[model samples]
Target: MKYTPHAYQRYAAQFILDHPAAAIFLDCGLGKTVITLTAIRELLHDSFAVRRVLIIAPLRVARDTWPSEIRKWDHLSDLTYAVAVGNTAKRLAALRQKAEITIINRENVDWLVKNNTFDFDMIIIDELSAFKSHRTRRFKALMKVRPMVSRIVGLTGTPSSNGLMDLWAEFRLLDMGKRLGRFLTHYRERYFLPDKRNAQMVFTYKPRPGAEEKIYEAIGDITISMKSGDYLELPKCLTNVVRVEMNERERRIYERLKKDMAAEIAGKEIDAMNAAALSGKLLQMAAGAVYDGEGQAVRLHDRKLDALEDLVESANGRPVLIAYWFRHDLERIRKRFPGARELRQEADIADWNAGKISIGLIHPASAGHGLNLQDGGSMLIWFSLTWSLELNQQTNARLWRQGQKHTVTIHYLVMKDSIDESVMAALSRKDKVQEALMAAVKAELGKE
Candidate 1:
């Protein structure tokens, strides 16, 4: 396909060409992959600045998305790439192959860094937020070899999905602590105040006055951010809340679980060991099932299932992508709609885009990033909710992205007066924080 670069897209590519260590906080559906790839093509061929490049991404993206993008674009056809995934033998074999770009999953970053010679000149982290934790093995491993790489790029839509604290680890890997600080403790001490702390430990932190702008200013020269609404003519997205209520008996069972942290539904004994376990159990019960003591899912009620059926039927043959959370939800959904297919493999993704699957099922975490399903359908149904703002936004972007033609409609089956309501509220609160962070560093591509 011929590539016609949008003005912002060109600016993003130029930003990468200019900075050795860069962070691009681009919104979903803004073609971050292609933009970064374009700059990489120039660096490899035009400038002859980078001989070898490494891209770290989620598992599926490493295996499929990057290679497919190289093949899809006419301008990127000259770029040679290989994917280093799977077991050690396969990964070693791919690493041996001479290619301009070598792609590997984030999970194996430690193994690659520890076992092999770190030789790539340029590195591109597809979802930089995945390395937001300084404690993770991948982040630690990448940091060990960070000084060796000459050029690096970090790309993400939800850079601060949780809060400004996430930017520390990310920028640490990018600029080697030049912007945020050398240590997480220093970053927190400088800009944040302890929040929700006991005498023993601090649970969370709130930024001090003027901290957000200070953080943004520190990273402004290296980072460029953009929102899709500000650049692209994306299709309208309509969200609907399909609320469901439980009957008296079901309500009593929910209340019993909430109070006692244990309840019996359909003769199965359900128990929650702690506050966290109780929250999971409550969400399961809200979704019409709960795991018993023996780990068996006990059916609570079919209110969500019935509501889903109505939405699927009303689609009237229009393909509907259903996002589920639990294994029990997938089993129940599959049993309810035998025709429902889970989008698991690359073949399944291709089939979905071909419009071969009418009713599709996907888990938000697995299908969250780097997979584009916009060509499949515009209607998405969240049969169950997730608490992560990153996963929620990424999953919704599957069908509501750039190439989508229709006014995408997202349906949420919220169980009233249940934990589902809390999840919805939490996602909204986190989104506001993320929006503020993005606005602080939003890119201004004035007059092209």
Candidate 2:
């Protein structure tokens, strides 16, 4: 395979060369892995300070991504790499060997360090957002081994979705508590307020405060931010909301359940405590899983299935990518679209991109990172909604990426006034909510 670099790849390679201690905030499906691999190759070939590279990623990514990337690029073919996913003894044996690159899952990093395994010259932390919470034992373990590593790189699309506090832990991993301070409490006091009413801390920033810009610029000094839309002529995403009407059977069951549950607690004071439980049961029923009087799941509404069928028909023979959330969703999708394939059945994501399969059904959480599936389909339909902006954006990028030639259409099937609508709303503004809470705290303090 001849090595030909895309424009973004070249830019990323240069950025890596310029900043040895920088993070790469690249979007999903934008060839972040290839860019990182190319950088590793350049580092090794140019005889930089880095000789051995350790890649810490998610379990599925560690098992399939690192080695696959090394094999894809001709330049990286000469590099020797090992994936750590076996019995403890086998992993230890592999660690003893002299592989130029080693990939391990983030979950196992603490164990590896605790067992005194071999260290590497450079550490690449993929999905760096996974380490956003400083309270985790894994974060502490990684911090303990930070000094021994020569170069540290953090990679993620959502670095600070929750708040500026997310930056604290990731920056700590990179430079041992330099940028965001040593403790989260200290960082919060500097840029946020402790909300006694909510028992939570919130970031404080005004439109013209210049605090966010200053923090972003400070981080930019040590990181390269890249967006897929910047370099890729991705297809236009057309989103359609399909509202499904529940059949009489479903409505009757729902009403009966609501009445019984209401009677069970009638005049007993409805509060947030019971309302939340009631809401869960309603959501479950809305998703076609209604509990019978005997507390068993009875089929309620197949409107979701009807909506999916309509979407497939509208595809007009174009390949479609379906994003499913629950096992029930998956079961319904598979039954309706038996010809559809899944992304997990094969190890090679490129196969899907190469048009070897049609109608790929993928779980957003599982399919929302590292892999590229742009060439596979240009249409995506959400079988259900989830309250995760990260998963939503990542899953959509699978088709709406650099290589896509057609307009990418995203279809969101939502039942009106149901849990689907609320979930979608939550996902759409999750980031804004965090920012709003932060601003609210700042306002409350200002009033004081």
Best by lDDT: 1
- How many Å off is the CA of 54 in candidate 2? 0.7
lDDT of 2 by residue, 162-232 (tens): 55657778888887767767787776667664443433544343222445655665565677665656565
Tens digits of lDDT, candidate 1, 1-448: 9999889999999999999999999988888999999999999999999999999999998998889889999999999998999999999999999699999999999999999988899999999999999999999999999988999999999898888899999999999999889999999999999999889799999999999889989999999889888887888999999999999999999999999998888787888999899999999999999878887888989999999999999999999999999999999999999999999998999999999999999999899998889999999999988888899999999988889999999999999999999999988888888888888787888634
List lDDT for all candidates, in order. 0.93, 0.72
Candidate 2: deviation at residue 441, Å? 25
* Residues forming the 10-long window of minimal summed lDDT in candidate 1: 439-448
> With candidate 1 superimposed using the best TM-score fit, by how many Å does residue 224's alpha carbon deviate from the native?
1.1
Question: Residue 71's C-alpha lDDT in candidate 2?
Answer: 88
Which stretches of model 2 miss by more than 4 angstroms? 6-8, 194-210, 245-283, 290-296, 347-358, 431-448
Error of 1 at 257 (Å): 2.1
TM-score of every model versus the real structure = 0.97, 0.82
Query: Model 2, residue 165: what's the lDDT?
Result: 58
